[model samples]
Target: MPILVEVSKGLLTQEGEREVFPKIAAALLEAHGLTGNSFMTPNVIGHVSVKPESECFVGGKSQSLAVVEVTVPAITFPNGQVAQKFIGEVTDIIDTYKAKPHPRERTYVVVKHAVDGPWGIGGKAYSNADLGAAIQKAAMA
Candidate 1:
């Protein structure tokens, strides 16, 4: 189960690189109890990409969101039951970060399950607040 975790921080603040991204990643890995090879294992491949928050927009509106796109191979779960569990586990991690008190701006964190075989699970738009909840919900379903 190669799970790819892609993290992208918005340019909403200058401290995103120095503070936000590392915090999010640390929370995620800790929540999963993944260490050593387990953390790097192909069961889940994680990637982090950061950019200025102003660049992300929707409907002509600038979205000051730091997006963390999580992609996991659908085949890894085989059945919906397993998929749900996996999703839930990841979601919990995101939720923890969302609960943190920080700037008033919106930061989107999304978890996308590659349903089309091994490569189709793309990224989704998520907020720092919704990251964990969304991922948990998707996995439990």
Candidate 2:
């Protein structure tokens, strides 16, 4: 799984720049009820990038914006409600990290589901069932 948090330069405070990645990653794990799980916790990978405002645009105009793209297994986000909550939480996380005067409307979040066959790790493609087994195995450790 991969989570990308991209923001226009100056969108986040200096401290936020250093901290938001882990915070957003934790939010994702919590949303999936896998927070602190030995297996899942180690698997949630993320990246945070700051882009120059001159290179960032919305509707053809330069804008300071935040975009969060999280990719997960197909079995995740089982329903609209779950997806909605996660989206809102991602926005809130951004709001918490935003520099003053950064508009909440500029925050964007997207959750993409990768079909099970391609969810590979350690040279092995992991299906949904394999993930479940892995999680269970870790829990028993």
Best prediction by TM-score: 2
Per-residue lDDT of candidate 1, residues 37-109 (tens digit): 3312323344445544466564576544444555543323346654455445444444444333423234344
Worst 10 residues of 1 by lDDT: 34-43
State the RMSD for candidate 2. Answer: 1.4
- Those runs of model 2 whose alpha carbons end farther than 4 Å from true positions after fitting are none
What are the lDDT figures for the candidates, one per model? 0.41, 0.85
Per residue, candidate 2 scores C-alpha lDDT tens digits across 1-141 of 799989999999998888888888888888878888898997888789999999899889998989999998888888898888888888887888788677878899989887766567778878888998898888788
Judging by lDDT against the true structure, name the best candidate: 2
